[model samples]
Every structure is written in structure tokens, then in C-alpha cells.
Target: METTHSPIRPIPVHPGLPVIGNTLEYLRDPLAFFRRLQRDYGHERMVRINVGGRATTLMLKPEETKQVVQENNRNYGRGKSFAILKTFLGNGLLTSEGDLWRKQRRLAQPAFHRQKLAILAETMIEEAVAWADRLEKVADNKPVNFSTATTDVTLRIVTKTLFGSSLGDQLDSLSTALANLNHFAINAVVNPIRAPKWVPTPSKRNFERATTQVNNLIFGIIESRRKTGETRDDLLDMLLRATDEETGEGMSDEQLRDEMVTLFTAGHETTATSMAWTLYLLAQHPGILQRAKAEIRATLGERSQPSADDLRAMPYSSQVINESLRLYPPGWVMSRLSLGPDRFGDHAIAANEGVLLSPYVLHHDPASWPDPEHFDPERFAPELSKERHPYAYMPFGGGPRLCIGNQFALMEMQALLIVLLHRFELRPVPGLQVTAQPLISLRPRQAVQIYLS
Candidate 1:
């Protein structure tokens, strides 16, 4: 009998110029590149990614991804994947590892807890109506970027829900600052980290200016709220009261800034992006849009507004949101650095390795989703009984660090969708293509326009 050795595994790699790795190409089109890797290499395989002189192995296996994200997860953190975000976010819960992140999460939990969320639901409905009214006023025979409208509504809603109704006074500056910061954040992903912060690079300069302005604004808000003797039921109140059970110490101002920045970014931008895509998707598929509108109308009635309770009554609307996330999740790619030498089904993954899990790729997997490109919401239907891997559909992620704002984002989107249906029937503008621009989140490349019918 001949001695048998284990078959050598092939780590997938695409060609790139020296030092740049696949940085330019990957930036040009992330979704396509990732899909190519999946096609050429079998599942549970490795992809040697060259991102500006860095060579990292990205594993795309759902099982391996589950192991990394959930079971064996540690303080592996956002790693270099989000190195640029640190300039804007600092040691926020989204980027911080270990005790710092844990403490921040605890401090911020109450603001998003059940009771406060109930209050927020009412606020969400009010904001939704306000958005619809604004659109109703602008129902001229003109083209509108439905994506922009959706993003604006969600942004204002999240700001209001997190800080209360007085938030609009600060939102204009916050919105501009966020827009500037998002570009810089993306540049930070591609540019060398060692470069001086004051360097003439437009992105770095823009980042510094935006962060300073945003911090001043955020810190001012925190200070004003702290000075108020009256305790209001919002995120600020919860942050003030949160104390570590073991240490009985509250988070300091610096810690608060980190958490606030994290929330400001995660709390709004992701929700805005998701809502934007959802509105565009509903516009693209009229049948689905009609069904969603019918559900929203039946549940909400021709009433003044739809409250939080009304939200629970719209299941198909929720299904549409779920399907949209499945097809175009806001959080497209997240990576975790390995702690030690590890083995995943005989692959000798090394210590300190960077492993990536992409919802964009997994969501579009043909083997997993039938007629994957079709705009079918049935994929997430409550009635469907088909078996799919748990990791195959990770919109908010899994494991210990699963997105705490999962409930908040979903509720916010549901409210926005309901109001959108009442205001107008969106019809797609021709010759415009909307594709996922992969970043910290999978933001849409261009504003998707629609007729405000």
C-alpha cells in the first residue's frame, strides 16, 4: 500500500504590482474580486490579499468564519482593516478590544435597552412622518435621488433618536462633517498609515479637520446634557449612569467620546446606507413595492401616523428589509486578526493572521441562494422552510460582539419604510446603475434616482 499524504490546499491569489498588492484593483471593484476568488478557489479556502505591501490571508468559509466570529473569538478586533477609522472613532466600542470595549458596551447598553427603545419607537414614527411630509411638499415633476432621500431621513431619525428632537440644530454640521470624514476614512484604508497626519494629503487633512470639528460638537453635546440636572430618557442618560458591576466605576469623558463616535458612525451611517438601498430596491421591483405598500397601508391605516405597535404588524415589510440586507448588507466586510497558530480543517492558519468574512459575497452565493440575482424577498420569508447555513446570512454578524444596534437598526428601517410607502410610489430612473462600493460598509456607489410618484 502506498503511503498517502494530505492534499495540499491552494491559497487563492490575483496578480498585482509590487508593493501595491491588489490595493488599486480591490478598491476599484471589491465585490467582483471577492466573487472571482470564490469561483476559482473552493470554499474554506484562503485568498492571499495584497493591500499596499501587506499580504494577508482571507478565509471565506462560512464554517471557518463562524469559528472566528463566534466560538473562538477574542479581542482580535477590527485590526488594520479599520486602522483609518481610529482617526475619527478613537477607541470606540467598534474598534476597541478587551476591557475598554466591554466597558463601553455596558455603559451604552441602557440607552438602547427595551424601555428606552419603546420611547424611541414613538420618536421614530414621528420622524418618519416628518420625512414623508417633507417629500410630499416636494412632489414636483422632477427627479429625486431616492437613495439620498432615504439616507437623509434615516440620518435625521438616528440623530434624533439618539440625542432627542433638538438634534437637528446640530445635524447640518454633523452631516457635512460625517460626509467629509467618510471620504477620509476610505482613503485611510488605502493610504499608508505611517504618513504624517499633517501631510499635504487632502484626505488626511480633511480627516483631521473633520474629527476636530465633530469632537467639539459631540463633546459640547455631552457637556450640555451633563449640566442638565433633569434626567431625560435617552442615550446620554444611560451613558451617565452605566457603572461596571465589578469595579463600580463609570466611563470617563474620553471613554464617552469613543463610544459616542462609535455610535455616531455605526448608529447612523449604516442605517442610512441600508435604508437608501432598501428604497432603491423597492423601487426596482414594483410587485414587491406594491405588496410592501399594501402591508404598510393595511397595518397603519389612513391615520395621522404609525406608532411602534404598528411596526410589529407589518411582517412583509420586515421581510423586504431582511431580503435587502441579505442582498446588499450595509456591513459588507469585517476582519479579525488571529491570536495564535490555528488549524481550520487542516489549514495551518498562522498566528496574527487577518481573516475576513464578507456578507456581500456570502449573501450572493449561488449555491446558497436560488436565482441569486433576482429581487425575490421570499428568501427571508417567515414561511420558507429551506435549510441554509447559519453563517450564510450574517447581516449584523454573530458571536459575542454581534452588533448591539441590530434591533435599533431594524426598527428604524421598518419605520422609515412604512412612511416612505405612504408618501410616494418610487419609480426607477433609467440608465443609472447602483453597485456596492465596499468600504467599512458596503455603501452604494452613486445616488439611485427615482420618480416621486
Candidate 2:
């Protein structure tokens, strides 16, 4: 009998220049470059590529990606790319890991529970209704910038729902500061060779100013709440009361500030972008949009606003959101660093190697989703979704570290969609091209213009 040993070949790499490696190419167009890697080299398998001098492995298939994100999850940590986010987000649930992350997640879990989210649904609807009314007044022959409108509404909803009231006097300055910080952070991620903060570059200066403003605003809110010594049953109240089971101590002011900023930023940006893209897609496909509207009409006839119960009844609305997420996930790519030597099928993963899971690639794979480029909400229909792998769709991510605000975000989006579609039929501007620019979130490259009738 002949004994045969399976060859242990190195992971295939996509061609790129030395020194900077794939940094410049990736920055040029992330989605295309990643798609090329899958189309040319992936073979429905993991491939190693150079990213900013780091040997990064891209996991494109569902089973292998499940190994990284869900099965052998503990052996991975957040990647170096996330290090830049810590300056803005701090050690909140999104950035922190290990024991601290566990403690925080446990403490914050109850706040996003179904019952808790129901309490905030009315506020979400009120904000959506108010925004729709405002748009009705201003909308005319001119095309409205849907991106800006959606962001404004989501921001207002987040502020009111989380703080128990609007930002009031601090809204303008805080909004401007957050926008500047987002630009600076995305620029830092794309341009690996960046000057240190002390080097006094314009972007750096603006970032510092914005950081200070955001910190001041959050700290001021915490201080004001502390002075009042009253419980308002919002996120701030929940955070104030969250005590560690072992330590039995509440979060300090600094800790509160970190979590607040994390919630405020992550809370609104991703939800707004997702909703904006859904409307954009609906405009392109009138038949699907009409189906969605008909479902809403049947489920919630003559209701002024959708309650949480109404959201559950309107299944197509959820499908539309799910399909949009499949096409354009806000958190397009998730990065994790390996903790130890490991093997997935034939490939060997070394200690401390960066691993990435791109939901965009997996969702678009022709093998998994037939006619992957086609816009079909029916892919997520309840009966059809039963046969798909659990890991195949993770707009809110998977495993223990899944986003805590998942339920909250879904409810907000569903309510907003119901209110907006009821009031206006969005028509895309003629000859206008809207492209997805992959940043911290996948946002429109420019303003998405739509005529609200």
C-alpha cells in the first residue's frame, strides 16, 4: 500500500506591490478588490493577502467563516484596524474584549431586551412622524437628499430615545463634531501613513476639537443626570443603575462617557445608512416597493403609527430590510486576530494573525444566493430562510459578541419605513448615479437625491 500525505501549501495571495502591499488598491475600491479575490482566488476558500504590511487571511465561505466568528470564536480578538476606533469609541462593548467586555455585555443586555425596546418604540415613531411632516413642508420640485434626511431622523430618534429627551441646545455642535470625527477616522483607516496627532495637521486638529466637544457634551449630560438624582428609564438611567454582579459597583463618570459615546455613534450611524439604502433600492424597484406598501396597508390600516406589534405583523418590511442588508451591510467587514495556532480544513493559522470576515462577499456568492446581483426580498422570506446556513446572513453579526442593539435597530428601521412610505413615494432623480462608498459604514459616495411626492 502506498502512503500519501496531503500537501500543506501556503494560502494563496492576490498580487500586490511591496512595502504598502494591498493598502492603496484596497483604499481605491474595497468591494471590487475583495470581490476579485473571491472570484479569482477564493475558490470558496480562505486566502491570505497583505493589508498594511500585515498578513491578513480573508474568510469568504460560510462554514469556514462560522469557524472564525462562531465556533472557535474565543481564539480570536479584535484586529489592529480597530485600534484606531478606540480613540473615538473608548473601551465600550464594541471595542473592549476579555473579562471587561463580558461584564459590560451582561450589564447592558437587559436594556435591549424585547420589553425594554417596546418602551422606546413610541418615541421612535414620533420622531419619524415629525421628520416626515418636516419633509412634506420642504419637499417641492427639487430632489431631496435622502442620505441627509435619513441621518437627521435617526440622530433625532437616538438622542430622544437614549437620553429621554433631545440634545436640545447641544444638538448642533454635537452633530457637527460627530461628522468631523467620522471623516477623520475613515481617512486614518484608508491612509496607513498618517501624521501623529501632535503633528498638528488640519484633520488631526479638527478631530481633536470634535473629540473634546463630544466628551464635554456626554460628561455634561451625565453630570446633569447625577444632579437631578431621578430615574427616567432611558439608556442613561439603565447605565447609571448597571452594577457588576461581583463588584456591585456602578460605572464611574469616565466609563459612562465611553459607553454613552459608543451607543450614540453606533446607535444612529449604521441604522441611518441601512434605512437610507433601503429607500434608495425601493426607488429603483417599484414593484417590490408597492408590495411592501401593500403589506403595511393590510397589517396596519389607518393606524397613525406602527407599534411594536404592528412591526412584527408587517413581514415584508422586515424582508425589505433584510434584503437591503444582504446587498449593503453597514458593517461590511469584521476583523478578528487569532489568539493561537489553529487549523481550518487544510490551512494553518499562526498566533496573532489578522482574520477578516466579509459579509458582503458571502452574501453575494453565486453558489449560496442564486442570481446574487438581483434584488429579491423573497430570499429572506420566512419559509425560504429555513434552508440557509445560520452564518450566511449576519447583518447584526453572530456569536456571543453579536451587536446588543440588534433588536433596537430593527424596530427603529421598521417603524421609520412604515411612516415614510405611508407619507411619500420616493422617485429617484433622473440620470443621477448613487454609488456605495465603503467607509466606516457603506454610505452613498455623494448625496442620494430623490423626489418625495
Best by TM-score: 2
Work out the TM-score per prediction.
0.92, 0.96
User: How much is 179 displaced in model 1, in angstroms?
Assistant: 2.5
lDDT of 2 by residue, 324-374 (tens): 999998988989999997787667789999999998888888878889878
Write model 1 residue lDDT over 115-135, tens digit each, in one string: 778788887888788888888
Return the clash pairs for model 1, or none.
Answer: none
Q: Give the TM-score of candidate 1.
A: 0.92
In terms of lDDT, model 1 sits at 0.77
What local lDDT score does residue 166 receive in model 1, on the 0 to 100 scale? 55
RMSD score of candidate 2 (Å): 2.5
